[model samples]
Target: MTHSEMITVLSQRLRWPEEKVSELLSVATEVIGDQLSEPGTLSLPGLGNFTSRKSKEFISLHPETGERYLIPPSIDLFFRVAPALKKQFEEREEE
Candidate 1:
């Protein structure tokens, strides 16, 4: 869902104001980004783990032009879903 939609849902569920929910989400993302930049993992109990890693530089070929180029190394972020959450999704799909 969109950011506004998520804020609306969170405000209703937490009995918080929309503005407050929005601020919370903003701070949360900032914190997550900061942690990821540190190359650390952030774990949420029922959600999963978020981690970041640096990938090595690689060479790439342009198929159409047959030109070769060097791709710079970069940091990649990834999320792994919690086992319980995965099971819940699997059950829903089976229904």
Candidate 2:
């Protein structure tokens, strides 16, 4: 779901104010972003993980020009959702 939709649902379920829900959503996303930008592991219990991979620099040819250039190593983050969340979706789908 989109961020605003999540905020609306959270506000109703938790009986929190809309403004507070918005703040909470913002903080959660900000924290996740900050953590992923670094080279480290983010392990959430019951959830899976967010890890950064260092891709080595390499030279690649440009498809059109056939020219090669040094490509910088980049950090990539991957997420694996919890099995419980997958099961929840499965059960919902069965309905």
Candidate 3:
């Protein structure tokens, strides 16, 4: 879902005003971004993690032109679903 949708849902479910929820969400996002920008890992129990790692610069192929261009090394966001979330998906498969 979009960020705004999340904020709306959270506001309703938590009984908080939309503005308050939005502010909290903004702060949470900014703090997470700042932490990630600093080159580290953020682990949230049963909620996966956000981490930064080094990668080599390489050429990337253009989908339309088939031409390659340089892709500089950069911080990438990697998300691995927590085991609990994985279990939820596996159960859905059974259904």
- TM-score of each predicted structure versus truth: 0.78, 0.75, 0.72
Comparison by lDDT, 2 against 3, better one: 2
Top candidate by lDDT = 1
TM-score of 3: 0.72
What's the CA error at residue 89 for candidate 3, in Å? 1.5
* Candidate lDDT (C-alpha), each: 0.90, 0.86, 0.85
lDDT of 1: 0.90
Model 3 weakest 10-residue run by lDDT: 86-95
lDDT of 2: 0.86
Per-residue lDDT tens digits of candidate 1, residues 1-95?
99899899999999999999999889989988888887768899889999899889999999999999999998899999999899888888542
> For model 3, how does the per-residue alpha-carbon lDDT over 15-57 read when each residue is reduced to its tens digit?
9999999998889889888888766788877888878766779
The Cα error of candidate 1 at residue 28, in Å, is 0.9
Off by over 4 Å in 2: 86-95
Residue 87, candidate 2: alpha-carbon lDDT:
79
Off by over 4 Å in 1: 63-66, 90-95
**Global local distance difference test of model 3:** 0.85
Mark the regions of model 3 whose C-alpha exceeds 4 Å error after superposition: 56-73, 93-95
